[model samples]
Target chain A: MDVTLAREWMRAAAGAIAADADLLTRLDAAIGDGDHGVNLNRGFTAVVAALEKTPPETVADVLIKAGTTLMSRVGGASGPIYGSALRAAGKALPPAAEVQPADLVAALHAGLEAVRKLGGAAPGDKTMVDAYGPAADAFEQAVAGGADLAGAAGAAARAAAAGAEATVPLQARKGRASYLGERSIGHQDPGATSTALIFQALADVS
Target chain B: MKKFINDPADVVAQSLAGLAAAHPELRVDTEEQYIVRADAPRAGKVGLVSGGGSGHEPLHGGFVGPGMLDAAVPGEVFTSPVPDQILAATKAVDGGAGVVHVVKNYTGDVMNFQLAAELAADEGISVETVLVDDDVAVEDSTWTAGRRGTGATLLVEKIAGARAEEGGKLAEVAAIGREVNAASGSFAYALTSGTTPAAGRPGFELPADEIEAGVGIHGEPGRRREKLRPAKELVRSALDAILDAKTFTGPVLLLVNGLGGTPLIELYLIYGEASAYLEERGVAIARQLVGNYVTSLDMAGMSLTLCQATDEMIRLWDAPVRTPGLRWGA
Candidate 1:
C-alpha cells in the first residue's frame, strides 16, 4: 500500500465517525469529554486536507505527515497519541513506495509503543489501548502465520471491535473518566471505541 | 436560546470570520479554521498552538495574538475540533522551526491533537506535544486520568506561548509547558450548569440552592454537589482542593476567573476570598491574575487557577502579551 491507499483507510474512518456521531458522542459522554466524533472528524478532515495539498510519495512520509498534522492541529490527548502512533509507525517503515502486510505490523507496533510512551499508561487502563493493542497483536500474529494482508487486516479490525466492546465494564485510568472514580465504571471506553473504528477503517481500505 | 449565531454548526466558523474582521492584525482563516498571529510562520521561531472547545470567551482563541499563541483552533462548544483544522493551524504556524501543541487533558481533545501532530510530522514538520493536567479537584492516584486541565490552561498558554515567542525551540517550549502543568492546579465551583445554545437547556441541573464543586468548563458533572455556601467558604474549598494537590506546594501565581454568567462584582469578591485563603496557607503569591480569562458558557461559577511559581515562571508571566481580549504591551 502507498500514501493514497492509507488515506483511503483514513477516509473510511472519517465516514464511520461521521455516520456514528451519536454513538461516538454517547460513548464519550459516558467516560470522556463527549467530543470523540467531533475531534476525530476534525483530525481526519485535516488529514484529507494535507493529502489534497501534496500527497506523500512514500508510505512512511504519508504516515508521518498525517501523524504530525493530527498532533499539531488536534488539541486533545488522542491527537498526540494517535499522531505519535502514526509517526512511530512511519519511522519503523522502510523507504518504499509500497507497503506489505509485514510493514503494517511494524507500523502498528510502533504506533502502540508511541502511545504507551506519550500517555504514560499501560494495558487494562480503560483506554484505546484496550482496543488498539489487541488489534495490533492480532494483525501481527496473523501476518506471522502467513495470512494474506487483507485477511489479517480484517481479523485485526474484528479483534479491535471486540476489544472495544469489552471495555464497557472497565474502570477508566485515562482522561476525564479517571476523575469520576467509581462513577467511571460500567461505561464504555470512548478511546477503545474510536480505536476499533480506526481498525475498521483499515479493513475497509483492505 | 438566543445567540448571535447564524447556525449552530457554523457558529465557530462564522465567529472566526468575525475574529478576523475585528482584528486585522491577526490572520484568521475561515477556510483553514485558525487564528494565527499576523507575523505567523515566523521564520525559524518555534510556533505555539492552543485550542479547546469554544464558548470560553477570550480563552484559547482570544489569547492568540503577538505575545501568546501563534495560532488558536476554535472547536464547537464543548467539543474538540476535528484534526484538519488543527493540521492547518500547525502548518500555518510552523515556520520551519517545528511546532508545539498545548493540549488540555480531556480525552477527546488530547487524542485529536495528537493525531494532528502526527500528520504534520509526516509532512516534515516536527511537532512536540505537552499535556496540561492541572485540575486539583480529581484524585491524583494512579486510577485517575490524571488531573483535569482546567483554568490553569490559560496560564500555560500565556507563559508557554511567550517562551516560544521568545525564541525557545520546540523542545524547550514543550518542556516549559509540561513543567507548568506539573506546577499548576485548579478547582471550579459552578453555581449553575452552563447553558448550551444548541441544547437550550443547562448542561446539568443543580437545584437553585446548590452548587457543584470541581465542575469543568465543558459541562461535565463535577466531583461533588452541595448546598450553596458563602463566597468565602466556597473559595476556601477551592483553594484547599488546589493546595492539597501534589504539585502545588511552592510560590504560586493565582488566576481567579469568573464563568461567563457571573457579574464582575461577584468575581472580585471571589478573588478576595481566594487571595485571603491562599495567604492563610503561607503560599506566597508571586503574581496574581484576576478576571474572566477562561469561562464556561453562561454558567454562574468561578475557578481558581494556582500555578506554583519558579522565577522563570514569574518572568514569563510578566512578559508582554497582546490579544483581542488580553493586552499588556499594546
Candidate 2:
C-alpha cells in the first residue's frame, strides 16, 4: 500500500460511514447506546479534514495520522479501540513510502491484536473484534496464497461482512450491549457492522 | 424533543458555556471541554478529577469546586471522554502531589481513563484511579462489562474530594474513594426514557402504566420492565436490590437522586418512603441528599444510593463544599 491508496481508503471509509450512519445508529439503539453511527461519522469526517489540511508522506504516516485524529475526535470506546488499532497497524508497517502485501498482512494482524488488547474482546464476543479478527485472518490467507493487494482486500472485506452478519444471533458478551443480557440477541452488533464498512472501504479503494 | 437547544450538535459546548457564565469560580475550557477549579493544582494537595458523559448534569462538572473535583472532563452526551481530553484534565489538575481519577465503571470511561492515566504517567505525572461500580441493576458477571457506576459516583467524588482537600496523599484519597464505592449501592427505575439531543427522541419507550425497572442513567435497559407501583413499593424494591448485594452495618448516607425530569417534591417523597422503610428495619441514616445531582436528560426517574459510612466518611461529608450543584458548610 502507498500513501495515495491509504488516503483513498480513509476517504472511502468516511463516505461509507456517513452513508450508513442512520442504519448503524438504529442498530446500536437496539442493544447498545445508539451513538455508534454518529460518533464514527464524526470521527471519519475529522480524519478526512486533517488529512486534507496537512498530508502525510508515507502509508504508515497516513494511517497513524488518521488513527490519532479518530482517537482525539471520537469520544467513546470506539475512539481508543479503533484509534489504537490503526496506530498499531501503522507502527507495524515498514517506514518506507510503500509496503508489500505481506507487510500489510502483518500490519492487519497487529491492528487486530491492538483491538483485542484494548477492548479485551475475543472472537464471538459480538464486538468489533468479531469482524476485525476474521478480516485480518482472511487478508493474511489471501496474501499467503499469492493474491495481490486488490484480491486480498476483497477477501478481507467479504470476511468482515460475514463476521458482522454472524453477530445477529449471538448475545453480546462485552461493551454496552452486554448489559442487556439475553435481550441483546437478534440484534446486529453496531461496532462489527461499522468495522465491516471500514474493511469494504479498503477494498473499494484497492 | 422539546428542549431549549438551538443546535443539537452544540449541546455540550453550549451547556459548558452556560456553566462557565454561572460559575466564575470554574475555569471552563470550551475548546478542550473540561472544567477545572480556578485554584486547582494546589502546591501541596493531591488533585481529584472525575468525569463521564455530559447528560448526567451536575455530576463531574457541577461537583468541581473546593471540596470536590479539581478538574472535570465532560464528554459528549452518553459518551466517554476522549483520551486527549482526559490527559489534559489530568495534567491541569496534577499538583506537586499526585492526582486521583474517580472514574465511572462503564467500558468506555474505564478504557479512556486508563489510556489517559498511562499517557500522564509517560509525562511524569503520578495518577491513581478509583473505579465506581456501585449500581446493582446490572449483575456482576463474566458475561457483562460489570455493574455500572451510577449515583454513587457523587458520593465517591464528594468523600474522596474531601480527603484530597484535607491534604491526604494520592493513595489515601483513592483508597477512600474505593471504599465509598465498595460501601455504596444504587438502584433506579425510569418512568420514561431520556432523549439525547442528537437522537431527538427518547432512547427507549415506556408505556403509561409501566416503568423501566433498574434503568441505567443513560436509559440503558435494566433488569426488567414492570407495572408501575406506588412510591412505597418502588422504594422498597430498590432497597431490596441494594441490600441483597451488601449489608450496611453503620449509619448510612442516603441519596435520593433525580434523573433530571423528576421534581423536588417527588424526590422528597421517595426519600421519605425510603427513610421510613430503612427506619423500620432499624438502619440509621446519618446523612442525606436529595435532588437532581446526577441525571439523564429529562428522564423522569430517580435512583437511591446508600453508602455504609464510617466516622471518617461522616466527618469528611460534613466538611465545607462550594460548587455549582452542591454547596453547604462553606
Top candidate by lDDT:
2
Best by DockQ: 2
- True-contact fraction for model 2? 0.67
TM-score per candidate: 0.73, 0.98
TM-score of model number 2:
0.98
For each candidate, the DockQ is 0.26, 0.73
Q: Worst 10-residue stretch by lDDT in candidate 2 chain A?
A: A26-35
Query: Chain A only: TM-score of every candidate?
Result: 0.96, 0.99
For model 2, what is the error of residue A152's alpha carbon versus the real structure, in angstroms, after optimal superposition?
A: 1.5
B1-330: candidate 1 lDDT, tens digit per residue: 666667766777777888889999899888767789988889999999988778888888899887789899887777676678888999998899999888887766776787678789889999998888887787766545667778878888888888987899888888888888888888898888776654555656778898888877876668877999889988887888777665565588888888888888998888788778777887777888778878888888888888888899889888999898778955
Task: Please list the residue runs of candidate 1 whose C-alpha ends up more than 4 Å from where it truly belongs after superposition.
Answer: A1-15, A41-75, A79-121, A136-158, A197-206, B1-3, B39-53, B65-133, B139-145, B156-183, B195-210, B246-253, B276-288, B307-322, B328-330
Candidate 1: lDDT of B50?
Answer: 83
